[model samples]
Target: MRKLLLPSLIIVAASLLVIRIFYLQVIDDSFKLKSDNNAIKIKYDYPERGYIYDRNGKLLVANQASYDIMVIPRELKNTDTLEFCQLLNITKEDFIKKIEKAKIYSPRLPSVFLPQLNKSEFAAFQEKIRKFEGFYFQKRSLRDYEVDSGANIFGFITQVNEKLVAKNPYYNSGDLIGRQGVEESYEDILRGIKGVKYIQKDKYNREIGSFKEGRYDTIAVQGEDINLTIDAELQKYGEELMINKRGGIVAIEPKTGEILALVTAPSYDPSILVGRQRSKNYTKLYHDSIAKPLYDRGLLAEYPPGSPFKILTGLVALQEGVVNEQTTFMCNHGFAYAPGRFQRCHCGGGPRDLHVGIYKSCNAYFSNVYLRTIGKYKSSPYAVDVWSNHIKSFGLGQFMGYDLPTGKKGKAPTSKTYKKMYPDWGWSGKTIISNAIGQGEVLMTPIQLANMMAAVANEGYYYTPHIIKKIEGKKIDTKFTTKHVTTIDKKYFKPMISGLFDVYNLGTAAGLRVEGIDICGKTGTAENFAKIDGKRVQLKDHSIFVAFAPKDNPKIAIAILVENGGFGATIAGPIASLMIEKYLRKKITRTDLETRILNTSLQAQYAKLGGLSEDIKLELRKNDSILKSKTVIPKIKIDSTKEN
Candidate 1:
């Protein structure tokens, strides 16, 4: 009986083992998947990123071949550390640190050890690469900027960080991603799908052949080409004009809302943020706290909109039936909203109607109109919100929904915002009358200001501003195509536009007109304040201008802001007029104005102000010297090949 029991147990155990083996092989392939992962090597085939062109079909950005040194930590074997470090032009400590980082990322997956190798470096390394184990070269493309300007618009591409890799499975260590502007906004379209090759490996950790006869392999797809709405000539010209100044300029097509030129002063050449030296150059630019070349003031710097906002005040008043074209308000060089508080103005003094209020920029007229609008509602909160809603409908105090990745919703104080500020006693229209003249809490970016003008030019509607004009085999976003109607009725636009036209004809912007172009515009001077020694100190005012050319049939809407530039007509207004003439006539009849802009240097204004640290100030001077050395060409004629 004991012998029979032993035989029965052995038979039962064998039967169970056989069934489990059958399940592992046929019914469940989990073990096979695990085995396949261990025995197969995956290689990536990176495709070229798309080309970028301007609206005139001129090439803006292209790609050049580059290489990277990839390493898998677990596959590494001892060779000559000193020799490898020397060949790569890196210290032994750097090599060790990189290896440690790669191990921390993954022991099996590949990581970038050294990247952006030029042609000569790649050639020299390829010859002796066989001596090193676990290391190989990965081919890729780097951005080749065709033009020298537009760094703020084109943005840059860089390697993914540890956080990004862990968050997104599609990305691995050393994967490239766009960082800002159009590159970031259209990454999916610009960065095409990468191909994968699964190669079978032996137990000895050597590639044998294709895994499963190359069934898991894929071919890379090239990224789609795109056309930008920017005009290369206009963009270059704008950058040239903003050379030594610190500010921003945004130009949009009034009919289509396509961005033409976006200029941020103190910006580096787009080429500097490309290729092997990108990191070093970027670090230098990023560290300049005083002259922030990397900061996009056009989209990010939220400053008071100034007198240009009165255009909206008038339009809103007209819409709400609080004021009409002929309504008059007496101004004594300012408006006394409260007993102790007076909003000062420079429009002289008279019985100013809506026309004179706009063209002459009368403070009392707009302030009274704002008060009347607020008085229409019983609840101050509701009243403020209604006025805020009317303001918001113009796309102010909100994101412009442009194709650029970065922006700020400039503060347009809502009822809730005011409630938090004056929580105890609520608030009154007199307490916030500064909003009538674009002061107190009203702020806007240059792009937003330009978009607002575009809306005014189109008579109460605007297409959301966008940079992409066309993408290969793909449609643009519906938002850019759809029109956003303002709360103000279309009828109010004609009257307001008349006031704006008079601004160019016989008012504040009278001297800033282009010869043949009927430019309807507004001039503004926003008071500048800075935190110095833990106290707010007033600096020179920032010059601002907003305009749309050929008032009857507008084509271009532009906004410019020059930091610490005194009055609106002094700097920003001339630049706007010049930009309009250049775009429309394709030639600058005002060479005098062009020369003034080109020769003027606000470098001292920027370096001295802003409460910059001593080190940052020194760095700005050093950087300026280097920039001058590069840009200042000798009077002697040079070879055309070396002109760029």
Candidate 2:
């Protein structure tokens, strides 16, 4: 019986093994796929990157022919290393490093040896292409900017590193990936589908023919061209107006919520980051700590919205039913909350109504209103949470989820925010009363401020501000089409609109009004601060302005913020008015204003951040050394000398 059991077990095991082998050989093709991979050499057909056009169909970004030297690590023979290095303008050390990197990526796969070669370089290298057995040219398209502006908007593309390749199976050793801005946001769409050609290789690794008669081969699909919502003329005009200044301007269409112009000052031409010079230019831009040209202040800089924030305050006050349109607050030059703790204001001391408050940017009226809103609830935390919710409903404290790949969630203080800060002290709305005037812990980006103005323009509703107007054979994201309604009721926005209109008629921006354009705008001068010598020193104010035009059927809503610019009306207001006029009328009526802004340069004011001047800074260093020498005690003291 034991002998019979042993034979039976052996037979059953053999039968199971045979069944498994049959399944692997016939039913499953995974092993066959792996075998084919070893015998097949893949040739990637990289498609052209998508064309980018402005809303008016003007070409903004096009592609130019670029060549990359690709290498298969195991395919190299007794090649002339010196000739290869000299031809490619690379060192022997660089060749070794690149070769090792490619091997680490995949010995059997192709990797970039030298990328982004011009036509001349490619022609020079093509002559000796047959000399190098492992090396070959992989033609690809490089971004050729049609316009010189909007580098921050278009962003740049670069070769995928080992880290990116390991994470995404779609990319290999030498693929391009978008870095920042719109390019990154729509990378999958813009990159298109890469096709592959598989050639059969013999035991000697010589190409024979197509694997399975090109059954697995696919044709390359060119990237889909896209239209941005940005108006090319408006974008250029806005960039021109912001020359030599550090600021951001965001203009949105009030009717559709399309981004008309996104301008960040101290920006570089997008072409600088295109070819071989891209890496060098990018490094230079990255190292520029001051007047950071690479930094997109339009979406990243979180400045105190200044008086532009008062718009949200008023809206929240109305929504909370803390104040009515006719609500009046007394302003004795400012709101004096606790004894001698006064928030100073420049709005002429008088009994000011809501209409009077907004145009004049009265600190007193809004502070009182803010305090009243907080007073409505029993607990300060409860009150603040309510206020924060109303503020966030306008998308102040969070990311607006714009199509751009980069941004900052400018802070709107909540109860939890204050609870952590004022843990021991009793607090109320007046405790953080600076918020009422767009001060305090309140901060907002240029885009957010523009969106807020758009809400006001649409009378309590705004579409999500987006950059895409149309994508080829595809619909823009539904979020861009969807309307975002504010917490404030529609009826409450009328009086606020009247106040904003009065701003152009009888307010701070009276000197910068456009003819035939009934503008509704607010000027803001948020106090700037810097740390000098371990002390928080107050710098010049950040000039801010937000506006919408036509007053009845609003077309454009815009926001501008200039760092170290003194008063809002002086720099930001004039720029905003000119932008509105440019977008709406397509011609500048105010030539003098345009000339003045073009001529004006704030480089001197920006330099003052380090010291009064180079001479003054030198003098201070000199004095600092002198003071240190005077305070120093003698190393060899008299007492020690006497004892010796």
Candidate 3:
């Protein structure tokens, strides 16, 4: 019995050993095959980005062919570092750092040595690439701005970081994405579909052939093209007008809701961000503290709307029955707020009606009207809340839902806001007296101001303001084309518009009015908080103007601002009038106007003691030089085709 038991035990142990060996060699083959596939095989693919164009079918942003030097650190062996660095025109340290970063990203995936390579760089690298392993050139497209019209509007594309990649499946490491403006708002539509290819590679990592003879390949579909509402000619003219100024301008067709011109001063050339030199140029722009050329002041700048807010107040007053078309208010050069502190009126007369109030931009008239309107709400609990809601209905103190991205919702203090600060006090009509004349925590962008003018011109109705008119050969739905109707009676706007017309024909803007055209306009001198010294002092006021042409049947509406430009009537009003004249009449009698704008220098202004900074002075000089030098003919040109 003992002998039989020993023999049985040995047989059982032998069977178990055979089973364990089979599991190790055969059952685990799938995991080993996957590991091998990941180490030796490589595939790289880039999807083509979308295109951008202007209203007239002109290309605004398009994809151009460029190369990136991709590296796989694990596969790299005994590479010619000196030759590679020399070919890329980069230092050895940079090359080593970039390679180390690539290794950190992953060994199987490709990483960038240089992005947005020009034709010359690509050519040089292509020649010496045969001697390198685990490194190759990947072809893709980078955005190219065509006419340099809208820097902020077009935005910029840059490499995707690890955080962005982890959140989104559509993007991988080393992908370019839109950072701001229209590019960001329409990223899904503008970014073309990405395609992939599966290819069989040998042990040496050489592409043998397609995995399934191109059967499992995705066909690359180009991105949808976007057509803007901007007119290149008008945009160029507006940008020219805003050259020396530190402000913004937004002009649009009231009927079509098309943006004719949108200008933000102190902007950089779009061409600088195109090729391999992008990083260097971007770094310089990023560090520039004074001019801040990269800042999109047009959409981002939030300043007091000043007298422009009176237009809305007028509409509200007329709608709420607080004031009629013939109502009048007495002005004494300054409004008595409490005692010595007065909100000054630009008007200098004793008494003025609604029409004269608009022409004179009477602060007291609007303030009285606002007080009366808020007084009706005194009996209600939701007085402040309801009043805030009424203001927001006009698209103030909130986002307007425009096509452009990252727009500011200018501050409009609510009842709750005031309540939080002074919950125990009586918050009555006089509590928010300053907001009536467009001051005291009220702020808005020039685009919003222009849209308000458009709404006024349309008699309390306007289409939503937009930069892109059409996209992908399909016109954007006219749903945004719907008109925004203000609560004011349509008849009330006629008299207000008449006063605005008188402003151009006989009042403040008379000096800048176009001949043979009925232009309606209003001006504002917005006082800023910035001071010249330790003592609180009034610096030059920001010149501001809002206007529309052919008052009976308005075609264009615009808003212009000139930072630290003194008075609105003299500086900004004329600029807007000139722009309107050029658009409506097709020419200007004052050819000197262009010359004056181009040649004007801020050196004398800055030279004043404690007036401006040295960097600002230098930047002004540089800007003036660039503008003056940008004439038809160059002073010197080296012609490679012709002999010296």
Which is the leading candidate under lDDT? 1
Ranking by lDDT: 1, 2, 3
Report lDDT (CA) for all predictions: 0.84, 0.82, 0.72
Candidate 1: C-alpha RMSD after superposition: 7.6
lDDT tens digits, residues 1-644, model 2? 98899999999999999999999987764456444266888888989889999999999999999999999888888889999999988899999999999898778788898899999999999999899999999988899899987777898889888898889988977789888977899999899889988788898888999877887789889889999999999998888888767789999998898999998877777887877878877776675545567778899888777787788888888888889988898889866787778788898889988999999988888888888888889555778888888888787889898899889999989888888998998787767887777777888899999999998999988888899999999999899888888888999889999999888889999899888989999998866566555555566667889999989899999999877677899899999999999998999999889998887777556655534435444433332221101111001100100000
Candidate 1 lDDT score at position 152: 86
Q: Is candidate 2 or 3 superior in TM-score?
A: 2
The residue-level lDDT of candidate 1 at 618 comes to 56
* Tens-digit lDDT string for candidate 3 (51-131): 887777887787788887778787788888898788778899998899889888887677876787888878877887878
lDDT value, residue 614 of candidate 3: 62
Q: Model 3 — TM-score against the truth?
A: 0.86
Off-target runs (Cα >4 Å) in candidate 1 are 1-38, 609-613, 625-644
Worst 10-residue lDDT window, candidate 3: 635-644
The segments of candidate 3 whose C-alpha lies over 4 angstroms from its true place after superposition are: 1-36, 39-48, 337-341, 378-387, 473-479, 531-537, 590-593, 601-644
